[model samples]
Target: MSTTPLPLSALAAPIERGTAAYRRANFALFLAGCSTFSLLYCVQPLLPEFARDFGLAPAVSSLALSLTTAALALAIFIAGALSQQVSRRRLMFASMALAAACNLLAAIAPDWTSLLLARTIEGAMLGGVPAVAMAYLAEEMDPRHLSGAMGLYVAGTAFGGMMGRVGMGVLVEIGSWRSAMAAIGAFGLIAAIGFAALLPPSRRFAPRRGFVARHHLDAWRAHLAHPGLLRLFAIGFVLTSVFVALFNYVGFRLAGAPYDLGPAGISLIFLAYVFGMFSSPFGGRLADRFGGRAPLIGGIAIMTAGAVVTLAAWLPLIVLGICLITIGFFVAHSVASAWVGRLARADKGHASSLYLLFYYFGSSVTGVIGGWAWQHGGWSGEVALTASLALAGIVLAIRIEDPRQPDRSDA
Candidate 1:
């Protein structure tokens, strides 16, 4: 990848701040973002079905989702670095196209191992989008509208997640899991084409001179050295891990426990994500008004309260708890993601990739640990584990000084 800086002025006009073409570009990008994540996570609800069909354990089935994220995290750094040489629009277009194909292949896999292999590759391909999208936005969108645009993009992600899980569950009831997966892949293919068509050619992206080993290393070091960035990264890990863990096993608890429910019934739980879709943008606005610190701390506090609510045996209380958790997670995620942009002086793509790497690592690791908690301690134990993680997030939030402080660099 070349290091030559693209003409910053050409791409500097925020898309959201520009003419009608820019607004169309932003909307198209939002759709692309939603489709990418929706396809990636559509397999989640089908995990239990995979376990039963393949005669595997819960942990083994989870690898279908976990392996994809694991591969995605590892691939993000490489993809981000590579995009320095490639056009952002072209890279993202190719990524969604390839990921869609991978999903189709996974849908027809004859066995569990083959399915996992396809999912891993899908994850790797999907890495291109998140690793580059933010930097693209920062380069192109007007500075005044950048945060709001990013917030909308984050909300799109939340919507995609809900649609993926809930749509899969509903579709699986109508057809087979394979069909559900295929449908999502088809949707992704359409979205990819739309994204390519709508995204204007980059005026600001200049090819990097070439890949330098030191550049990558320096970028990582600089990102890690910032106290605010480091704290945000840690929070990203814990926040996502705790969130994934809670959702991974909540269905199991509901399906088997005092509130016995079927797959369809379990699917309804994802409706809580609607709250997340709203919360993300709302959180971003709050961050703008009150600074990131208040939303970060307040979100974690809500999450802790939600985790405790889940401890109750009552079904209604459980639903309310899940809603609270959903709201908290989105608020926290929106704040932290935007904070990364504000914190990094350069190599914004690399900084975003590092944040997501930690984000998904938490998903892969604590997601599994959460399963262990489920098996041994049951729902109560899982709640305890989630609460502990949220508390850690709260502590991290408390330690994050204001980004406007003298020591912090204003990007």
Candidate 2:
């Protein structure tokens, strides 16, 4: 066996911490992460407003966000394939700009149908961000800095998701929902501009000259063939299904109950996301100290307990439940997402895309179905659905053969 080491000149030098380029890259990704999520979910807290204004059922009103996520789930595959040919910064910049424009269009949408159409388009446009961002990081960042960068990026998404719902509620309370949408749309546009200006062009990425269907398909096939990857994908599906479904209906429940809440007051509940932001890093630590499985299952248990807590008639208990759910969701997602990267020795981009496909698919499908549960059976029905999904997540985590095999890459 040859004992000779390769020269540094032969390797691609990676972006490391404490550099101008590193700072710009992380901040750019933070903006991209924040803008994509905030715009995608800004409609969440306003489902009641849509129902009242449009004379639609809760299930129908939820299509504003649900349709967008569904379209995003489908478009992720296409975006993953497209990344081969497009420059990372340009593709992400275009996506951010287009999505912001679509959000503005939704703001001025004349009717429910028009709003849904605009939102779906916005979702499809956002396809360029999440998975692509992950792939870009894997390609550009030094391995030592990758974990820290990933955590910060995920934190941005958490912060944005919280602000989007809370800000929507506060804005709608001050003005109309349309004006609120416009304000958020403008925020997204600003973020896009900042992202494009700040992000360094990819130094390590090689742009494929043309698309190759067979090569990409084979990569995806290999990821799906792995048992651990499949389980993580299922966990992604359940984690989001339980979290988004419950949040989707909580606004409806609060809007019409013994404790009626206006948009602003209800938005305060979303501040629970602050707890989620903290929990994500903490979850990674726990996974490091004890392998991924313990924390993964424990997080789901927290979620299950949280779901059951909401069954109480007291408003404080319901809010507490929501907070627990948020914390658990981030914890589980942090572990599971990091695990996906470790599991895929090759085609990491395709693995990221497949995982997110299930993740947002859950958001789109169960987000609306939870509304059905809310309409037919009320809060208890929603709890029932979420609890079942949490249980499924537990079972999936149990079946994973070796969660401890994951490396230092913790999201």
Candidate 3:
């Protein structure tokens, strides 16, 4: 494939369903989502490995991911603004490339502190991906088919998240966590190059060309002031908080108590994300027909039930619970993220950024809170925390006004 970007004339018009541009754009984003999320989350299954090797406390070990998410949350806010002045495709590609290199550095780090630093930087690098990606889909894809296109992107993330955890588990089993990290990093670098070549240059996005502090601050203020957007932002926050919190501590439960599973065994558990991979696109299709309200609430309801089901002592029930969580989370996410594009009248990048700002902030915060819940209250306590947040997500989703213009995020 030629490295030269697609000319503006090629993609100036909105990408319609079944068109070559639509297929190319979606596939490129699929790669982008796969690389970005796999790099971000590959360490999730490695939490145990960190504890065993570093002789750290459970909460302390979680800082590997929590700190990265924390940095990512803040960086997302900055990157949203930065995207205004840069090429969305180039920014995303660079972010992916640098982040992959950072992981390689992390793979060789000699101490816990060094690893944490590398991960944090990796998080910062990833900030460019999500918000920009959402903006890109919202801009380039035909408005009539936004739901389906966004669904494909979310499905990519689902697959990436799955492989990140699942692949890390398998890799660490065959070699070591260090080698696993290096391998995923190398894959991300390749994906970055591919993404840079495949993603059509922006036609809808009018670059601002400089740091217009006043404009950015105003955009943030406007998004914050919009009641509907705030509801979606809250929904984004609750979604990740509950999801990350549960997955964060579940490893300890599987490692100890009733089930004593090794990295490979526990990794098989993350195969649940396959459910997520399917649910996301289905959810998007649902949104296109029904509207955002039904699916958003429905997804959250499923998540709440899944959290409760995990309380069961049976092994099958626990795996079923994880699958339900994965399904519900992706559905809710696909709906909510697409809805963000619908509701934004302008400055789409800023709007997407604000939404993800809340999304990742929740992930970072809950990782620690979930740790405390696990340490003090065990799996039941973790369930209590997730279930409550999920319930709140339902309430917020209910309050959000589904925009009729662009379409619903309802599947």
Clashes of each: 11, 0, 3
Q: Per-residue lDDT tens digits of candidate 1, residues 1-411?
A: 544574555444546444786677667777777887897889888888999999999879988987888788888878878877778889999999999999999999999989999999999999999868777766666544555556667788888898899989889989999999999999999989998988887666675777787887888888999898899999999889878899889988998857789878888998999998789878876775567888888988898899899988889999999999999998888888877777776777888888888898888789789989999999999989989988989889898877553222222
Q: Quick one: RMSD of model 3?
A: 4.4
| Cand. 2 TM to true fold | 0.85
Q: Please write out the lDDT profile of model 2 over residues 101-206, one tens digit for every residue.
A: 9999999999999999999999999999998887777667765455456655766789889878887887987999999999989999999999999999977666
Model 1 CA lDDT for position 143: 49
Q: Rate the local accuracy (lDDT) of all candidates.
A: 0.83, 0.83, 0.87
Which pairs of residues collide in candidate 2? Answer: none
- How does candidate 1 fare on TM-score? 0.90
Please state the error at residue 311 of candidate 1 in Å: 2.0
- Give Cα distance to truth, residue 40, candidate 2, Å: 1.0
lDDT of 2: 0.83
| lDDT per residue (tens digit) for residues 56-94 in model 3 | 987788788877877888888999888878899999999
Q: Which candidate's lDDT is highest?
A: 3
Query: Candidate 1 at residue 287, lDDT?
Result: 72
Per-model TM against the reference: 0.90, 0.85, 0.91
